[model samples]
Target: MIEMTRVSSPSDIIGIRDLQALNLKQNITAEEAIDQGFLTAAFTIEYLQEMNVASPSIIAKVGDKVVGYALVATKEIRNGHDLIEGLFDAIDKSAYKGKLLKDVNYVVVGQLCVAKEYRGQDLVQKLYGHFKDCLSKEYTYLITDIAQANTRSLKAHKKRGFQIINELVYGEVKWDIVLWDWNLTD
Candidate 1:
């Protein structure tokens, strides 16, 4: 059985890093990336450790083996990583430009990936759902940016109710800044 939960132990952190490495190396083709999703940027273990210390990431595991993960970050916690810090700054500027997302508490989905063997199993949605269940009360939105080339990730995120809130180009790559409002009142 697959279990989705927050990273809580050293083994969980290692598992996430291992799975991230595997996914990064496996999905090389554009078709493969579009079909299974791909992660371009890499994170050091030290960086992940700091992120977990601030806000634990979500992991999907089966029998003690991690198959997927979604890294988490708050506004204050993201400044430690240069790339993420830049992204947050761009997001802040874009948010200000639109005059939306004001005075709202939010969390960033820093990175998300699934192991090649686990791609079709819906682990991504499960991980995000569990993360939201654990954190939505404290955060008004779940935000992330997806590269324009990453169609699979963008489609899946949209299917899960995330909307494109802004667009920006950074590092020569176009990104869609997506958001999921957690505080929607029906």
Candidate 2:
């Protein structure tokens, strides 16, 4: 009974936070990180609430339980957080196919995660497809960064049509900035 939809209620926000807690790099062990991928930044419900206000998240739910999510961070999020600002700064200096990314119309995937029980069910791709279906009209690309060591995430993004557009180090962690251009993918 899993369904794909936008974040529509306060509980969905908490669901995202709960799932994120289980998948963070520090929360998982090194072995699990290598095998399952990992998230770096830790965000509060307040921050997620703010981001959702500007752009609602794509989520996979079963009834009221959120099993997975792809959070969209529009330009309204820039300069409001330290780590995000660094990502934006790097994106501003980055180029894809000779055109600077800053000059392109895009939104960042603030965070993505699927509950452990929901993994291996093609839920990741399902969430991304929902992103395109809902956001492609307003945005040309969906952009985000994955830690270089988070190979699982990088491969998944590439498999989902995201291209590595740039790279940078923030908080001493090297990240691969990726983008899926809907104009090209759609």
Candidate 3:
């Protein structure tokens, strides 16, 4: 049976490992999915471990086999306030200024991946549902950015009701920084 669980505690190491392995094989390390200028799949394992203990995140599994994972940043960066300020300044000064940024309690989607064997099983869609359920209480909404060339993720996110609120250009690549306002009041 498949289950969605809040990833909290060291015992969840196995699930994180499984997610990392799946991500390495299909998304980052795979030639067809090489995403340069972004964190590699290898980093996802540590990211999950950190997020599981540090923030609101979820891990999906089937009998100890991790099939998918999602991360939400419901809290502010503890000591990275300066970094956030700099990022916002750069963004505001850029062409995408005067944009709306509401219910943006989450800063990033550290990682969201499914095992290759589990692809096309609607696991990702289910994971999105679970993630929304988990975060809607403590957080207003979630936000994430994707490379414009990443068509699969962009399509999936759009289908999930995320709108492209702003576009960012970094180095030689352009990113579509989207926002999904989960808070109806906002």
Query: For residues 3-87, what per-residue lDDT tens digits would candidate 1 score against the true structure?
Result: 8888989888899888777667343766777677788677888888999998999888888898888999888677777768867
Kindly indicate the candidate among 2 and 3 with the higher lDDT: 2
Could you give candidate 2's per-residue lDDT for residues 88-134 as a string of tens digits? 88887988778998898888888889888889998889999999999
lDDT per residue, candidate 3, 135-178, as tens digits?
A: 67765546666668777778777878777867766546676766
User: Scored by Cα lDDT, where does model 2 land?
Assistant: 0.88
**Best-performing candidate as measured by lDDT:** 2
Identify the candidate with maximal TM-score.
2
Spell out the clash pairs found in candidate 1.
Answer: none
Give all candidates' CA lDDT scores. 0.82, 0.88, 0.59
Worst 10 residues of 1 by lDDT: 94-103
In TM-score terms, candidate 2 sits at 0.96
Which residue pairs clash in candidate 3? none
